[model samples]
Target: MIARKFWVLALGILMIGFSSSVTAEVPEIGQKAPDFRLSTPDGHPVRLSEFTAKGTVVLVVLRGFPGYQCPYCQKQVHDFLLNGDKFAAAGAEVLLVYPGPPADLDQHAKEFLAKQNPLPANVHLVVDPDYAFTNQYGLRWDAPHETAYPSTFLIDGQGAVFFRKVSREHGDRTTAADVLGELERDKAAHAH
Candidate 1:
């Protein structure tokens, strides 16, 4: 009986520690998007600031557990590939982010890129393992049964966000069509 009670206390402490570390990250819209530098699978270092080329920058925050490939992320990335040209036509940059613990990043990023992904010339896939960038943006999920809530952000060249989408569940997410449509609308609105 004593041993069981002791085990319960230990588990409770661990849960508290785990929750604090992850649940604290909450990125919001209309704020300056956090800039980060991370390496791709081929060791190319990419930064969020680099994508803001005279227009809005779309940031796709993905979950990178490496133990499992997330379906929502895969679908969203695939959609981006299919509509890459439309985004290019709009003159917007697409930046995909995969965040996790340091150890799983490289392997998971490779698996992520294994499928033929024809991103637009302005699109970039970035690794943000360790949640360094995610936590700063307040978009880290950090809960059980979640890597991160699938979130999308549209940042202006000055690094200010004009639009953001954060899914309440893994099944709900922003897609390529949605992003392209948004880019068109924002550009039109600002142009006027």
Candidate 2:
């Protein structure tokens, strides 16, 4: 009976350790954005640090192919693309994350991009197979018919997030105009 109790205590401690290691906290404003590496749709490696030279980095986390291609995700991409010129004018780079299961994630991202070919120079489409980026940012939805909570953050050249929005629902999202306005404000704040 003593041996049995010892084994149970050991297992309990192990479970607690494992669970704590798996959890991550979402970054807040004025905190350095967590760094992660992912590949662009074309199979080229891209890192969050790579965009630091481009001024503000507008990070968009999509729901990915949760159960099917999300229409709201498509519309959000279009909204940003439609304002590509404005983003460029503000010297900002947009990184769109398409996250889902590891199988065929690249192909899924490619097909999604086909809807709006010729992405803007300032914009990049990256795939997060196996939810590495999503998990790191603590945005995983982990429910039936959902993959991740759509989110957006504005990271400055120094990699500090100045603005953040994570939507629990699909419809509400930050628009291009909203990000653009924040970029202008960020610029003004940095100038001083």
Candidate 3:
């Protein structure tokens, strides 16, 4: 009986792992980015479409307030903040997604942005309440103590994703310089 139970439990765990992986849709390059409307930490509604016409968008997906504040996410945010001028010079706007359970999600996002009071105009931090945007983008980590994988996408004014980096785990992410380089390349291509 004990051996039978062990096999059954193992099967269940396998099924869960498989299902989780199947759920997330990888955002492919050269595809139209999934449009989404989510609110800022202070309850302001912002849509991905709003930035499509103005300039290139640096879309950042974070492992938001999952059971605790992700140190990697914090570092990534700071890295972008440090390179704010560079992003602007590249004609890019950075929009970050903070996702978690629906309940008190805004509050958690608020706490997460506590250090970034009066965020720069080009930097917009939005909350993904109830994982709506997370699921839409197929980035939901779907594991215990995790919200969504860390992903970054560079979208052009035409609304097509030109560059994408989706990290299955923490730490593997696209750097500011990397994104800036892509923007420059895109500009050069267009100029030709």
lDDT against the true structure, each candidate: 0.77, 0.91, 0.88
- Give TM per candidate: 0.80, 0.90, 0.85
Candidate 3, which segments miss by more than 4 Å at Cα?
A: 1-24
Each prediction's RMSD to truth: 7.1, 3.1, 7.2
Give the lDDT of residue 64 in candidate 1. 63
Best by TM-score: 2
On the 0 to 100 scale, the lDDT of residue 53 in model 2 is: 62
lDDT of 1 by residue, 1-192 (tens): 999999999999999999877643444666777677877766799877777657778888887663578877888888887877887788778888887777767788878878855556877887877776777767778677455668888888888888888886776788888887888788889888
Put down candidate 3 lDDT per residue, 1-192, tens digits, no spaces. Answer: 999999999999999999876764766889999888999978889999899889799999999888788989998898888888888878889999999887888888888888977777799999987888888888888788889989999998878999999999988988878888888999999998
Model 3 earns a TM-score of 0.85
TM-score of 1: 0.80
lDDT of 2 by residue, 1-192 (tens): 999999999999999999968867778999999999999878999999989765789999999888678999999999999999899989899999999887888888999989788999999999998888888899999898788899999998899999999999998999998898889888898789
